[model samples]
Target: MIAKVMRGQDTLGLLRYLYGPGRANEHTDPHLVAAWRALGVPDPGRDPDADLSVLARRLDRFVRPEVRRHVWHCAVRVAPTDRPLTDTEWDHVARKIAAAGGVAPLGDDRGCRWVALRHDGAESHHIHLLATLARQDDTNPDIHNDALRLRDACRALEDALGLRPTSASNNTSAPSPTRGETEKAHRQGLDRPSRAVLERLARRAAVASRTEQEFLDAVRSTGALVRLRETGQGGPAAGYALALPGDTAPDGGPVWFSGTALAPDLSLPRVRDRFAGAPAAPAPLPAAGPWGQAATAVGELSEHWDGAGQGVRAAGAAALGDVLTAAAVAAPSHVRQVLQGADRDWSHAGRPPVGTARAAVAVRMREAARALSAAAPKGQAPVGELAVRQALQALAGAAEQVTAWYRSCSWEPQERSARLAAEALRAAVGGDGAQPTLNFTM
Candidate 1:
C-alpha cells in the first residue's frame, strides 16, 4: 500500500469534489465505504451543503484561520490481492487511521473530521480521505512526523491483515525522494532513472576494491563521477558524493547525492565494511531452483535497461527469453516447497506450501524476463504470448491455494509471505516498462 498526503485551503471545494457525483461526465462511481465525524454530531451523509458546513466549521478552529489551507487530504492505494477486504477489514483500517494520526476518539481533545471512500478503478483498491486539521479545543494537533508515523502504522496493519509490506513500511535509513529532486531529474531528459543501477554498481565496486583509489576508479568506470570530500587542510577524506555526468539539475548545476542518499546499504560505512572483510552480500538459498540462471539473465537485462546499445529495443526483447527460461527453472522448487511442508523462514507461522514461495520467485523472475524481452533478437521471435499467460496463470493458482489455506491466519508469517509472493508476482507481470518495486520484505 502507498499513502499520499496533501495539505491545502478551500476545504469546501475539495469536500464537494470528494462527495459530489463522480468526475465531470464520468459514469463510474466511487463507494463511500466509510465516513464519520471524530467529535461532531452531524452525519456526513446529509446534503452536500450541510456536510461542507460541518467540515468547514471544524477546520476553522485550527490556529491558522485561512480556510483555503485548513484541510489535509490523503489517499491510500493497495495493489490487487487474492480477494477484496471485507467490511470488518475496512473498519479496522478506519480505526487504524484514527490511532495512527494521533486523533483522540472520545475526549475533550478529539480531533479531525474525516471520511474514507474506496474506488475500484483500473487500479484495484484506493481510499480517499478528506479531513479537518483542527481539534475540539480549537487548536491544531501536532502533525509533525505524521507521515513517518502513518507509515509505521500501515506496516503494523500489514502484519495484522496479512498484506504485503510496502517499501515505505521497511524504510529505516534512506530519505524518500522529494519533489524538487524528481523534477530536476525530469528536466535532465531522464525518466525515473534507476537508482538501483547506481547502488548495484557501488556495491560491486566496494566488494571488488581493496583501496579507496580502486573504489573511486571502479565507480568512475560505471559512468558516475565520484567527488570525495576531505577534511580541512588536506586531512583524510570525510565523505563522498556521486553524480551522473549527463544528468543535471534544472538550473544546470550538477546534482550530487551521497551513498546514504541513494540507499542506506550503500553508505560509506556499510561499503567499507564489505572491503574490511565483512561477509559479502547474501547468496540465494539452496532451494532457489533456477535463481542462479535468473540472476545471470537479470544482469544481462540490466545492461539493456542501462542503455547498452543504440538499438536497446532489440536487446530488451532477447533479454526476456533469457528471463523466462530462468523463471521456468525456478518455478518447480517453489511448487515443491508448497506440496511438502517445510520451514522456509523462522518467522513463518505454519508450514506454508512450497508453491507460495515458488509463486513469489516466479513472478519476480517473469517480470525481469518480460522487461528484457522488450525487443526480440533481429529475426528471432520471443516466446508466445499464450505461453507467458499460461505460466502466469499457474503461478496465480498456486497463490490462490496459499491464500485459501491462510484465510483465517492474518497474523501468520506464512500468510504474509504468501501475500508478499503474490504482490511480487503482480509487480513482475505488470506489462512493458515494468520493473520490480524494490522493497525489503519479511
Candidate 2:
C-alpha cells in the first residue's frame, strides 16, 4: 500500500468525488445508509463540502448514536492495468478482513466497488470502508497509527478476499489485537530494512559488474547475510541466501551471503534478485555531487570496459551525447529505437522520417565514409560488397565516438577520464621523459 496524503482544497467535494460516482455504494443503495445509521457512523453525505478537519470532531456524533459502529477509514488501491479480481480473489479479501478482526460480510454492492471508477484516465479501483471497530476502546492508540494500521487492515482484508501478495510488503509493525504480544515483539520492528536502504543497495546491484565473491562482499558491505536453504527447508543449507544483518540477532547469529546467479550474472542481476517479489522498485539514490555523477557514470560502465570508441558500441551513447551536447537533446534510447523502426519502414516503403539525432548520426557516418574513401585511391577504394559493408560499419562507429567526444567537450563515462589525466602527467614529464625511472624524484 503506497500511502500518500494529498491536501485537497475542498475536503467535502474531494470526499464526495472519491465516493459518490453513479456506482457509489451510498448513491444506489439504501441499506448502506441504514448500516451507517445502525452502526452509529457519521452521515458523511450530509454536508458535501464540509472541511474534513472540522468533521473529525463531529465523528463523535456518530459514535454517540450507534452502539455497533466504530471508526475505520482507509483507502485500498489496485494497479488495475494488470489483472482483475477473479472469483477466488473475492473470497480472499473477505477472509483476510475477518481474520484481522473485521466482522460481517461487506455486502455485494460494496464488493462491486472494486470494478468502479477512473482516476486520471487510468483504470484504478479503491476500497472505501465504513465499518465498526472490532477491538474494544482499550486498544492502544499506537496500533491506530496510519502506517501500521492501514497495512494490517489491508493485509487482513486482502487475505479474506484472496488479495494475498496483491501488494509486496506485509508490514507487521502494528500491535495486532489478535496477536496478544508486546514490547519484545514490537522491538523486532527495528530489524526490518527500509525501502530507501534496500533501494540504494538494489541500485548498486543493478549496475555492479562484480563476480560472485566480489558480489557477496558488496552485499556484506551493506550489512546483509546470504544463506542457502536446501529443498526450501532447514534440512541442510542448499545454498547461501542474503538476509538483513540484524534479523538473526533475535534468534542467534548472522548468515553468509551466497550469491545466486539469476540473470546474466552481471552486477544488476544481484540487485534484481533483492526485489524479485516487490511490485515496484524503490527510487534511485540521487547521484551525489559532481564527483558522484562521475562515479555513478563510471559505476554504470565498469568491468570489461574499453575506450568508448571500441567496436562493441556503447549503450545509451545517443542519450549520453544528447545530455552533454550543445544540440537539442532527445532521449537516446527512444531516438535509437525510432531510427531503427524508421529504417525498417524505409526498407519496406520509401525513405522514412528520421529525427534530428538520427540525421546527425547518418551525416557523421557519411563523412567517415568519404574520409576513408579519400584515404584509398579514388576508384580503387574498397569496392567489394563485403569490403564496402565492413568499411561502412567501421565508419559509422568511428563517427559515433568522434561526435560523442565533440558533444561531451571534456569527460566521458568510460576510460577517457583516466587517459586524459595520464596524458597531462606525461606532458609534464617533457617529450621523451614520460616513462618513470627508479632514480627520478618528484
RMSD to the hidden true structure, all candidates? 14.0, 22.4
Give the alpha carbon lDDT tens digit for every residue of 1-442 in model 1. 5566788777767756765654432212454555454334443444333566765565455535554465667776553322456656765676576556654353434676666655543224556666677766666667777688777777777777756545532242234344344334444545444343465456445534555666788799888878887788887677788887765667987678888777554677645532332223323422322333345434443433333332332223222322433343233333323312211111122222221211223233433433322222211333333333334434433443444445553434445654454444545444246763322121
Per-residue lDDT of model 2, residues 79-157, tens digit only: 3322445434433443333223232334322211111112221233333333333322322122224455445666445
Instruction: Provide the lDDT at 436 for model 2.
Output: 21
Q: Please list the C-alpha lDDT of all candidates, in the order they appear.
A: 0.48, 0.30
The candidate scoring highest on lDDT is 1
Worst 10 residues of 2 by lDDT: 345-354
Error of 1 at 354 (Å): 32
Per-prediction TM-score to the true structure, in the order listed: 0.45, 0.25
Off by over 4 Å in 1: 1-10, 13-34, 37-95, 104-111, 116-128, 133-151, 160-172, 179-196, 277-442
Task: Please give the range of 10 consecutive residues that has the lowest summed lDDT in model 1.
Answer: 339-348
- TM for candidate 1 is 0.45
At residue 26, candidate 2 shows an lDDT of 20
What is the alpha-carbon lDDT for the whole of candidate 1? 0.48
